[model samples]
Target: MAVAAFPDPDLDPSRWVPLRYLNFFRLVIAGLFLVAGSELQLGHEAPKVLVAVAFAYIAAVLTLGFPDAARRIGLDRLIMLQVVIDIAVLATIMWASGGYRSGIPVLMMVILAGAGLVAQGRAVLFFASLATVVVLAENSWRFFSGRSSADFLQVGFVCIGFFGIAIVARLLALRAKANESLATLRGVALAKQQAVNERIIRDMQDGVLVLGADGRVRQANPSAALLLGVDSLEGRLLAELDESFSDFRVRCASADGALQRMRASGKLLRCRAVGAGEDGEGGGGEGATLVYLTDFEEILQRMQQMKLAALGRLTASMAHEIRNPLSAVMQAAELLTEEKRADVQVRLVRIINDNARRIERMVRDVLALGRREEALPEALILAPFVASLIEESTLGGAAGRDVFRVEIPARATLGIDRAHLHQILDNLVANARRYCSGKPGSVRVFAVDAGGRTALHVLDDGPGIDAAERLRVFEPFFTTHPKGTGLGLYIARELAEANGATLELADNAPGAHFVLTGRTQP
Candidate 1:
């Protein structure tokens, strides 16, 4: 039985080249035989027969070795036919040139070994058997016709050698095939791993670049391309892209440290470079470096969120502890005010009551931070909602109806929790009313469609916020107003975010403008 046959050429493309190489080997051997035979006058006793056999052999090899002919006849059959032809033609040439004494049969060993390899050790012993039979028959015929003396022992040893070589060739071919299969499997696995790595690099938010010793980009992921403000980064010099990259590369190569630099595109990136090796050790001879870029703004935002989270936890715990003492202080102040005392005593009681009430409001706002109720959002028409909020704010006679102007589309809608929206608008409008001039249109409430969301803007005619104060206006317990608890805007923003909305202070020139951007529909 033969070992596993070579994989089909249609399935494994590597199979086709070896078969073509075998055919070419056969052609070369045939041509060499014709050339050597004619030059040496190999068949002096039967020159015409020798020449005719040689030409016919060459013609047969060419016809059978054609690529299309092999494909049409099928690979196994074609290989079998080629090996058989090799045995017959070579044996005939040996007979014409004084039989095995001419050393022509030695070439038969090469044919047998090659056949075993090409067919992946299949049917090799059969071809050896056929060659052995033909050689022995030729010896028998020569002895019987008195043309030459028979050496049966010599022929037997040669036949044995043929079988031995064929068997060894088969074993070698089997080992070769096994190794090739293992290598192919490893190659496939490596390719899959490479694809996964590429996908990870491509989808990463941080930019990554691989640079060679020449400071040129050998490979770059999509984020790297975007950060560099280029379409592609491969094969381009870092210095050519930007001077900052050159400096960054130099700084990183000298030592492992990050370079925080802003690019021409106005993006602040923190770049760090490391050797492309295990544990950031030196890589190959080319000295490759892996550069990473992170956005500075995002880093700052993350830090701010961490700080705020810690503050919330601290304030929530403190508010719980302060509530009981704060209530006691207010009751004591009220009891003291009931006594008929001096005018100075009355003024001191008033101050105590006012401060106690303010602390109570602050404690209430702080406690609200811990209770984040789930928002139930619904769509509300813009004009009527603002009109109703304005009416409620003015019912206390703090301002007249005409003091505030509502400039919203009648059909425009906003998506938010009903109570949450009312609270947000009330806080904004009240803040606007406190700051604006006491005149019509001094405090304006307007709405505009922003993409699929609606932005509700509350503008006042009061002095606009300072540039330095803009960033901290939404922070809890941070306010410029003396009487303000400062948690109103913070709580309002928290509620806005709970309903998938954003409240921000827009940079309007004349006055403080707060914009509440929310979904246009529920």
Candidate 2:
């Protein structure tokens, strides 16, 4: 049968531990032999030589045990050399103590077994054979010299026992090493999987929390911390953090893992609690609970956006039908204006034209929403771009182009679609012009660096937006002005996002401020 291969002890530091243990066993055996030689009548043939050989063996074992011995002599050669010394010294001791009859030859079994375990594979069989030959030679020499009786059968049995023990020890050692390697690999795989899971949970948008049976937090992700409005929730009691959490946990537990809702940081959160098991039984073996939190307001906004998208598509499909009749009404109003109608008739025709134009603008805005185009990004320097855009704005021409102020760094840049930027700026600048005092700096446009990004700010010197209307400012069909179409700001924000940008309302004390933050490099 083929022998199993094992790792080298020199390369695998942990395997060297067994070699140290083997050396310690040698020391113990040598010590016992020394004490026996001093006190006991071991044999009549050279008792003094027995004590001398024991002392020599002790010195050899101690010398071989130095830390650098393995590195200098090489591990395999070192172990082979130690086995040779053990056999030669033990055989000498046996010959002095009456050969095979003194029972000293039995110590060879321990030496062979230690060698087998420390140096596995074919080395084990080599140690076993070497010890058998040395002991048999010692027995033969003693009998031929007439110093002891012939005991070939006893010597043969000891040799057989040596081979049996060595083979068995070597096999068991190989099994143990194989199992250890498998365990190490499994541990590494489990650690990597745990790291990936932690990263996913940390970056997740929804909140995740782990709570012990005692209702103390065990782990919390960043999203959970933000949703709960706390710096950290780990190791803190749920009730201490907020009564809403305490009540939510109780309700989820009572309802047997049903979804629940609770108010946190003035926002409604959709919450669910589950145990560790696949079935989500609230009290698994660990008695721990996994809780998930989602923003109910965000869910509502998504539903509203779906409704608005559907409404926009429907209006777009009927836009042509509506505009055809509206065109006829506007043409008839124009003819009436040219005919020099009476005062009341002229007033009615003017109102008709104005209402018809408003409807046409509404249809055009709805169609634009339905035909949301993919953005084509390009690099744009902010200062020149803002200056040119302000000059082309409808309100800028009436208010005088110089009335708008631009403050951008010489190298400030943005990665956004040109047409998208033009539309967004037109809406914002028009709003600013309508509200701001007709002064050069009443409408200010500036850009600032923001963490490798660029933020373009547009502010007007007018009464700031009321807090109540701020929340609805970005909603479609919502407006504070009588003649304004509510879709302007909403469409502007949408266009910004289509180009990987964000349009946000900033808290400015004296005027309405809008900031568009986007990529700095293409």
- For each candidate in turn, the TM-score is 0.56, 0.55
Model 2 — which ten-residue stretch has the worst lDDT? Answer: 1-10
lDDT of 1 at 414: 89
Q: Model 2: clashing residue pairs? A: none
For candidate 1, the TM-score is: 0.56
Q: List the residue pairs that clash in candidate 1.
A: none
Query: For residues 75-185, what per-residue lDDT tens digits would candidate 1 score against the true structure?
Result: 778888888988998888888878878776688988887777766444888999999999999989899999974589998898998888888877877787789899999
